[model samples]
Target: MAPTIHCVRHAQGVHNLCTANHVIPDPLLTDLGHEQCAKLREVFPYHDKIDLVTASPLRRTIYTALESFEPVFQAHPEFKLIALPDLQETSDVPCDTGSEPQALQQEFAGKNVDLDMVHEGWNSKTGRYAPINSALRERARAARRWLKARPEKEIVMVTHGGFLHYFTEDWEDHSQYQGTGWSNTEFRSYTFSDEDHNADLEGHAVDGDNATLVETAESRQRRGKVGPTPDRAQQKTLYQLGTQSWNQQLSTEEQDSAKVPEGEEVNGVRV
Candidate 1:
């Protein structure tokens, strides 16, 4: 099997939270914010396998990485840092970009006038709780390319808490509410492999055994990677169904709504 790819959300920031009143803004992790990441740095195989390093375009995530990955750079100065916009926090907290604060709850479709009960239907720009699924999948696809170029090796992504929360919790089934919020410092791995021969220069296979797999808890725990995974099958399944329903509704909405011209450009970027 190819090495495992680990996705870590940065430790809690001062601004790291969901708002009961409205969308959270500008809170960053405290001194202990990056402390968990710092401790994690001592455990993972950053020195052994990690071939690529990327982060969300957010400071919390970036700062968390600086502390955790000090050893990685000292060993490989040539490794470059890439910032992915898609991997950024979705609630639209504006920092210096001057955009107004986009409430995380308002992001959902049917936000009750009351602050607490956010509906899955009316939750995001995409109107899906699992937009993070799209983001994570894109990262995986990008991983295929990175692996092809680097040759069979692990790729580590240092990212945000919400993204990791959705990925491990609701991804396979699609759920609106994230099952669990992430701990300040958590290391989760999703492994990818290729079975088909249309292999890239790096070695990704296309067909058999080509599908990605998750490593076992025993294996991971044995390695002293991290912990706290209880059996979460039922909750995950229910959320998955809800996610599927919302996606179907969104598809219908898109079909009904008139779209811009195929050739149309918005700010030098096409829709």
Candidate 2:
């Protein structure tokens, strides 16, 4: 059977509590973020079905996975929980920086997660250059290949919001309502294909391409209203969750100018 991937974005990190544009390297979850993770544990419907749990090496993501899925881990020792450095967020921004693997093992302490598989400097950032965008795209594709190779029928990954966009490559502005990208602690399930993964590896640019996602029937049922555009209230909520706030020092005109066009997307995948 084809594997089903449950992609989850970490709950609000310490950086999220700030107004905007301020960067804090590899911060942990805020109190509210922890609360969100706890709520996720209560509401998540896939605990029994998930056979594998993977998390980005980032602190926030690791915490989210531990808080939300530790029960599943305890209940099913046969299920594996592995940390993947390649799954880190797709930005060179300070907030996206990750800690070393050894530090992460010490941080988790008695947790059941496996930190042995991580490579050295797996958390290092590529410099802020024009080509880094393409490199991140390829990294996303490579990570997809890695995940698909796993033998588990159902897998769960706790990662960052920015990278989840590239992971799905559904860069549509319409994707917000389509369950393409994610909100805090949100989980969306997708089915992967070797053919689609190969297309991305064989020179298809994630920026221009619409990578078709095969969402599970359960995923579709759980998704919000389906539409070309989100309603006004939904739009406000999305703007708050999906992008950085404009600098308060800037004039309204400057902020408007900085905003992407209403019908267009800013990040690869987001409204």
Candidate 3:
């Protein structure tokens, strides 16, 4: 079966060169960002299986998708890059509030979408549609099921960090959600996964690390970790659980390290 879509965020861009009200920043990836993409390719050595690539239309996301995957896709028969407007960053609020008018608002505006807490106010008091995100998620869930229907393929989507963290469901908050994006050349491949694969990982905290978590449908419905798992900060990195390419390259160590089998998938998460 194919993995759910990869859903990656774009590389870093100039945060302060310029900013303006209603203006989006058009920064490119930085040197450090390039290094990070290289690290991503090395860590996920089996990147050629991606059947398709998609991205938000923003320059950072488009450039990131092209720079990171072109090497792997050169030999791919069905690979092509597409765009999804739904994956764009949260709309920038206007500059009507004169909080910081030292200069043009353009310089500092890009920073707003960097990395903030996930949108929790689904039903804000304003009764107006709160962008504490919802529709984006509904669309992604639909997208995930649609992709999984295809067999033997992987999908890559490069977008902004906000969509990656707050909207993409399979991640289970496993994403580092660090303030910065990958270096211009660096990229990471996230397995589009179902909740069942992680049933064994829940309530299983590694040291003070409350952030790195997994979930299954039944348990997630019953004992949702209300906000942070309410623990001390411990160190942990994102780790893969499974993939077709991974199975082929399964060293004894890797076979042993995988958290679950290939057939397992959370039906509740399946549309």
Candidate 4:
């Protein structure tokens, strides 16, 4: 049986404060971010059930996985959080890009986090890591395949907002203007679709099919609301916009800020 995956967006990072902070290379979580993780740790219900935890190699995500699931790590001394490069954000901006492995190792020396999968050039935006639509799609597929092959019965993946849409292949509420609808540290449970089970993992059969994550009914109930399903055109548009170059997207965001009223705010940040 496929693992029950819980997808979580990392808590508030410095870049989440405002567009200017996006220049802060691989910024850490803000104080509020840590506080959010603490709340998640308290509220998260599957602490004992999770067999493994994984996160994007970015510091904010690593910290989120460790802090939010600290109980799981503490209970199982044999497990270490696996940092997967494929789980990194879709954008190539400094804030989204990761740091060197050595620097991360130094910073998280004593932490129960593994960086073996985060190889050199993993942070580079070139090749498979590029923010192009094709690359992002392939990366998301590879991540799903990897998760399906894991032996764990349950898993947690702490990742970024923009990339979550791709990873789950769910764009029902995705907004090109606002990015993902997922709030910081918010998570939803999912399981591999039946199509995923039927497709041949070793061959290219899964490539043509939409072998993706299916949000559990319980997760939907937990969310308390479900928007209308997006049409194909809308999904395509959202995916294209979401996968655009981060700098280009940031420029668009800056241009849009001019339209905001003086006292109004965008993304909880005063514009």
Best by TM-score: 4
User: Model 2 Cα displacement at 199 (Å)?
Assistant: 3.3
Each candidate: what lDDT?
0.46, 0.66, 0.41, 0.79
Give one digit per residue, the lDDT tens place, for model 3 in 3-97: 64555656555431222212333455666556546655565544766766766545566667766776655676345565444455533322101
Evaluated at residue 3, the lDDT of candidate 3 is: 61
Using TM-score, rank the candidates from best to worst. 4, 2, 1, 3
Task: Give the CA lDDT, 0 to 100, for residue 180 in model 3.
Answer: 21
RMSD of each: 14.4, 8.1, 17.4, 4.7
Instruction: Give one clash count per candidate, in the order shown.
Output: 21, 0, 17, 0
Which parts of model 3 have CA positions greater than 4 angstroms off? 2-4, 16-24, 93-132, 150-152, 170-271
Q: Across residues 172-253, which tens digit of lDDT does each residue of candidate 4 receive?
A: 5665334666888989999887743333312234545455677888887788856434534456665555545233334324
Candidate 1: worst-modelled 10 consecutive residues by lDDT: 92-101
Off by over 4 Å in 1: 1-3, 17-27, 93-152, 165-181, 193-213, 217-238, 241-271
Comparing 1 with 2 on lDDT, the higher-scoring candidate is: 2
What tens digits encode model 1's per-residue C-alpha lDDT throughout 1-271? 4556577767665543332211234345566665666677887655566666666545566556656776766677776555444455533333201111234323322411122222332223342323444543444344344533545366666765445533334243232223223345666676543433242212334332223335456545754647533334543454455444432223323523523123322222112
The estimated TM-scores of all candidates read 0.53, 0.73, 0.47, 0.84
Candidate 2 lDDT over residue span 111-203, tens digit each: 777888676766666432111445656666667767777788888989876677666654434245212347678888888633432244234
- Quote the lDDT for 70 in model 3: 64
TM-score of 3: 0.47
